[model samples]
Structures are given as structure tokens and as C-alpha cells.
Target: MLKKTLLAAGTAAALSFAGAAQADIIDLFTTDQNALILTDVGGPIFSQVSGANILGGFRDIGLQVFSDTGSPAARAIVEVSGGVFTFSNDNGIGGQATIQWDGGTDALDPGVLNTTGLGGVDLLAASADRFILDVLTADLGFPFQLRATDMLGGDFTISLTSAGPGTFEIPFAAFVGVDFSQIGSLSAVINTAGDTLALDLSVASIVTNQVPEPAVLSLLGLGLLGFGITSLRKTKTA
Candidate 1:
């Protein structure tokens, strides 16, 4: 009887382990005005990037000015107006902004999802399997780059060209050898010559996959312990 109980527990645990795969959805934009803004030590959602360092700034990120409230809450919609890039801080100088998705080390924070510890390869593979971007605009400029950076400072960039704008599935497979475990942030940068470029772009949604919690491991361990206890009882009875 005890042996049977042990075998049943082991089988149940194995089934649980197999079913551990799950999906986590993160919304970049919401109708809630009080939504938690993505930020890091650099600043709020928008910041100025110079020489690998992000500085605090409002308009520097170029996102605050281009937002579409008319869009549905299912995704964030942004439209870029005309902006000139200047070197003297008079206009804007090749703007780039980073939005941190995994809230760093703050357990109590609302944005905390605790994904930095996941294995890089696992994260990237999972994301690649389930990643989608819905773009609602017709023009997103020419030669814009979308970048994802890991905690180890490894960056994978994808150069995007305007295809008359529609739902775009991000080529997560392009991020080969990236440390997905520490996927710290996502950024967008526009490359233009002569420090002046006309801008028109819009993004509707960004959806990606993430690993499930480690709770299943604990449950498996418990199941194993129970199985061991049952086996010991069977040995004593015999």
C-alpha cells in the first residue's frame, strides 16, 4: 500500500512538473493614468542616453510628446511628431530611451516580476516562441533600430524598416547568444544624418512570453519527500 502511495505521488509530481510552462503578459500602456511608469536609476520612462549612461530628462526621451490616448487599452499607442536633432541641447541629439520591464530587486514594488534570474537562453527561447508587436501607424521612419539589453550588458539590435505599418512580429530569434536571464531593458533609437530628421511613427502593442515561477520546484520537492517517507514505511512493514 505504501509503495503504491509513493508511486502515485511521484507520478503526480512529474505531471505537475510537465505542466509548469506558462505565459506572463506585461502591458506597456494602460488607460489608468496612475499606471506604474517604467524607470531605473537613470530616470522615469524617458531619459537621455549618452556614452552608455542614461541621464534624467523629460523631453529627451521623445516619448512624452508622442502618445495616442485614443487607442484601446489593450496596447500602448504612440505617434512621433516632427523633431530636429541638434548637438548643442537646443533641439534633440539622436534620442534614445530605455524602459525597464523587470523591476529590479524591489519586492514590494508593483512592477516587480523577478525575471532577471532566469537563464538567458531559456528566456530568449521562450520569448521567441511567443512574441508579437502590433503597430498601428503607416510610417515609422526609415532605419530605426529596436534593441534589447541583458543584465550582462549584452545587446541585440534589430534594424526595422517601414513596411507600411501593421502588426509586426518581433524576430526574437535574431537575439542569438543574448543573456535572456538578465533581460533588463528595451530601447528604440533613430539613426539619421545631418542631425535633422522628420519623424512619424506609432506602436500599438508589444507582447512577449516569460518563464513561470519557481514554485513548482518546491512542490516537486515536497512530493519527493512524501514519496521517500512512504517508501521508508513500506520497508519497515516488510
Candidate 2:
């Protein structure tokens, strides 16, 4: 009777934990699966690049760079390729994006989702516990904001302090008035801050993190306890 009870408990725990683990992660985007490349040319008043990520329902990945002086003859190059977003000012000689300057030079990379991409529109945000972004930057020139918006126009913005490299995890509760079931997009903006002549930003991946509920945790613990008792009983009997 003792052996049977222990075996049953362990089996039940394992099954429960396995089921919860299946829903623990949802991939948003990864370069190994999709790639977006963009670049700017000299003498263009407005230069931009945009494309689909081809993963999680073909979400859009785009970037835009323009002259601060509104000149059709300025030379500044900004590009994103091989997962790295590079902004170069040509050693301060070129009129590159001065993010906070009145000249209006800046960069915008709007990572817009397909809404109905990740498992459908209803479950996209509802199923996700939090959003995660994996990035590496070389002291970003200015403060940047990661903004998320829902289909209903409700939005939330997360500020990212200047850092070299790190992972950002945003909880769903942080968003105000945003409908989780109707998530629309995520965008990054660096519009109102001092600019650095040269900057490199690399994005590794983006994903969601989901954790098992309390009941699942309890089940896991019970399973471990049962296994320990069973082992002890067998050793003593032998």
C-alpha cells in the first residue's frame, strides 16, 4: 500500500509539471529564424527600411533615419544588418542624427507585431506572462523608450537607461488600460536625448516568460517528497 501510494503521487506530480512547462515560453522573434536589414544613403532627406520578421505571424521590423537639417544633401549612414543596429556620425564630421537636437535628426525602429501572429489575436497577450528583450548596446547616446500598444489604442512605455548589455523583462500588469488579448505592437524611440556620434546596438532575441502557478509548484514538491520516502523504504527493506 505504501509503495503504491508513493508511485501514484510521483506519477501525478510529473504529469502536472510537464503540462505547465509546455506553456512556459513563447518566442516572439529570433535572428536565427528571421533577419531584417536596413541602411541609409547620403543625400537623402528621408531614408527608411522595413520588412517582415517572418516569425510569430510575420511581424514587421523596420528602421528610419533622416537628416536633422532637412537637407537633401547631408551625408549620414545608419544601418541594421546581421542583428546589429549601427549608427555612425563619421567622427562628428557628418551631420548624423542628433536625437535631441532641434535639427530633428533621430532613429526609430518600430517592432510591430502582426497582432494575430502568436497563436492568434486573442491569446497573444493573454497567454504571455511577461515580455523579454535580449540586447547589447555600447552606451547608447540617449535615453530610449520601449513602447507597447494594444489594439484599442491603450499603451505603456518602459524606459531603458543607457547600458552596455542586458535583458529587459516587462510584466503585463505594468501596462495601463492595455488589453492583453489584443496586443498590437512594440516600438523603440530615441527622440529626446543627447546624441553620440557613433553607437552600436545588437539585438539577440525576443521572447515571453511564463511561470507555473502555485498549484504546480506544490505538486512538484509533493512529488519530490514521495520519491524520497520511497527510496528510504526500499533501502531499509533491502
Candidates' RMSD to native: 21.3, 19.1
All models: lDDT? 0.32, 0.37
Across 76-176, the per-residue lDDT of candidate 2 in tens digits comes to: 44444565443433222222321110111122422323322233233343355555555544433334455555555555665443433455444555455
Screening candidate 1 with a backbone cut-off below 3 angstroms (N, C-alpha, C), the clashing residue pairs are: 120-180, 120-181
> Model 2 — which ten-residue stretch has the worst lDDT?
1-10
Count of clashing residue pairs in every prediction: 2, 0
lDDT for 232 in candidate 1 is 9
Model 2, residue 233: what's the lDDT?
9
